[model samples]
Target: MTSQLSADYKVDHFQKKATVVGLVGAAVFLFAAVAPYIFATDVTSAWIKLFYLISLATTWNLLAGYAGMVSVGQQAYIGLGAYGIFVFNDMGLDPYSSVLVASVAVGIIAFPISYVAFRLRGGYFAIGTWVIAEATRQIVIRFDSLGSGRGRSITTYTEDAIYRNLFTYWVALAIMGLAIVATFYLLRSRLGVALQSIRDNEVAAKSMGIKVSQTKRIVFVVAAMGAAAAGGIICLQGLGVASPNTIFGVNYSAFMIFMVLIGGIGTIEGPIIGAIIYFLMDYYFSQMGLWYMVVLGVLAILIMLFLPRGVWGEISHRFNFKVFPVGHQVQPLFPGIKLKKK
Candidate 1:
C-alpha cells in the first residue's frame, strides 16, 4: 500500500512559467533588435551602455551569488577582452568579429587563472582575484603594440557613423541576451543544483559527491568570458581603449557588486532589476559629480540595511512567484491521497 501510494507523488520544476517568460523575452528582443530603425542613434547608443551593464551585473551575480565565489578581479577579463579586440582587429578581423574572438580567448586564459585563484578561500579568494587583475593590467601595459600605458583606437572599423552605431547596438543587445539566456538555462541544469549546493556549504556539497572545484572552475571561466564580451563591446563602442586603467578599473567590479547586491543576490531576476536601477541613477545623477557617488553609496547602504535580500528578493519572498523557477516542487498526483506508515 505504501509503495503504491508513493507513485502518486512527483517532483516538478515549473517549465510553463519559464516558457512564458522566454516567449515574452524573445518578443522584446525582436523589438529591441530593430530599435535603431525606430529611435535616434543617440537614443539607441545609450541602450548599448545599459545592455552591457546588465551583462556585467548578470555574470557577476552568477559567479558570486549562485556559485558563492566573490571575485573582485573580473575586470582582469574585461581588460583582456578590451585588449583582445585590438590584437585581433590588428590581425585583420573587424571589431565586431574581434569581440567574439576576444571572448573565447579570454575564456581560455581564465581556465589557468582559475587554478591560481581556487587556492584561496573566503576573503583570501576575493583578494587573490584582485591581485590577479592588477597583475594582468601590469602585464598588458608592457606591450607597446597594445598601447603600453597609453590607449589605442580601432583603425579598421567602418567609417559610417550610422551603420557603426547600429552594428554596435545590435552586438550589445546580443551579448546582453546571450548572458540572460545562458544564465537561465544554466541554472535549470544539473550543474545549477550543484552550484547552489556549493554556495550553501562547500564541504557539505563535497560530502554529497559534488565536484565543487570543477563546478566553480566552469562558472569562473564562463563569468570571465561574459565579462570579456562586455569589455569588448566597451572598446568597440568607444572605437578604442583610451587607457588600460579605465578598462581594467576596479570600479567596474564595484559597480557589478552594487548591481548584484541591490537587485537581490542569488536570483537571476535580481541582477537585471538592479542593473536597471543603477543605470537610471547613473544616467540622471552623473552630472552631479561627487554628490552623485555619495547618493549611490547612501542608497546602496539603505537598501542593504532595509531590503537585505534586495528588491526582487524581497518581492519574490512575499509574492512567492519566480519568473525563472529553477527549484523543484513536490506535489501529489491525487489530492486526497494519504500514505499510511508501515
Candidate 2:
C-alpha cells in the first residue's frame, strides 16, 4: 500500500517569454529617455507628453482598476501638484527640486481628502470627488501669490531651449519610470492581494480581515502623489502655466479614463499601450481641430463597444499572454515524461 508522492512548488508572476520581452522593453525605453539630447525639441516634447500621460493613466488605473475606486476628479491632485511647483519655487527651490515638493504636497492633501471622498460610494463617490476638485480650484483661485485665475509660470531656470527641453524631458521620463516600477512592486506585495481582493468583493475582503479603508487610503495617497508628479512634469515641460482651469480641468480625468479604458483596466501594460495610441492620434490628427476631437471620441466609443475589456485585455484573454503578469498559473511540470517504478 506504499506509494510515492512528489510535488514541486512554483511561483512566478512573469512568464519566461514575458521576462525576455520586458528586458527588451526596458532597454528600448532607456534609450528613448536620452532621445531628447539626440533629437529635436518637438520630438522630445512629444516624448515628455507621452510619458506624463502614461504616468497619469497608470495611477488612475491603480485607483479605479485595482481599488475599485472610480474617481472622475483626479484633476484635483494634478492641479495641486502644479501649484506645489510654484510654492517650492517661491521658496527658492529649483524646478527639479520643486517636483518632489509638489508630489509630497499632493500626497498630504489627498490624506484628508480621502477621508471625505471615501464616505460616498458608487456614483455619489464620483461626484463627491469632482466637487472636491472644484472646491479646491475655487480656493486656489483666491490666492493672489498663485496668480489667482490668471495662472503662474516657472521662471526659475534661465537655460537655453536645448537645456530646458532636455532637463524637463528627462524628468518626465524619470517620473514615469518610477511610477511603473512602484506600481509593479506594490502589486507584487501582500498589500496588492488585499487591494485586488477588496476590488473584487469588498464585503468578502473585509470579512477575511482585510483593512479595506486603510488599504484604499494608501492607494489614494500614492495615486495622488503619482498624479501630482505627472502634473509637475507637465508644468515643467509646458514651461509652467498652472491655471486653475487647465491644470484642474476635467479633461485630464477624461484623458486618464480614456487611456485606461482603451488600453485595458486592471492590467499594467494596458495604460502604456493606451497612452501610445492616444499620443499617436493626437500628434497626427491634431491639425484637424474639432474633427480630431470627434474622431477620438468615436474611436473611444468603438473600443468600448467592441473591446469591452480593452484592447490589451482582449488580446491577453485570447492569447493568454502577459508581459507583466500578476496572477498565478499552474502547468504540468513534466509533460509526456514516463515515471520510473521503484
* Best by the lDDT measure: 1
Q: Which lDDT tens digits does candidate 2 get at residues 1-342?
A: 844333433355565755776688789778987686678888888888999999999999999999999999999899888888888998999888798888998899899999999999989999999999899999989998888999888878747877887888878888898888788778878889999999999999999999999999999999999999998988887778746799999999999999999999999999999999998998899999999989989999999999999999899988877777576554335666444432
Clashes of each: 0, 0
Candidate 2 local Cα displacement, residue 52, angstroms = 0.4
RMSD of each: 2.6, 4.0
Candidate 2 has an lDDT of: 0.87
- Against the true structure, whose TM-score is highest? 1
TM-scores of all predicted structures: 0.97, 0.92
The global C-alpha lDDT for each of the candidates, from Candidate 1 onward, is: 0.94, 0.87
* Pairs in steric clash, model 2: none
Per-residue alpha-carbon lDDT of candidate 1 for residues 1-342, written as tens digits (9 for 90 to 100): 347645889878788888988999999999999989999999999899999999999999999999999999999999999999999999999999899999999999999999999999999999999999999999999999999999989979989999999999999999999999999999999999999999999999999999999999999999999999999999989999999999999999999999999999999999999999999999989999999999999999999999999999999888886788788777779869665532
Q: What is the lDDT of residue 8 in candidate 2?
A: 39
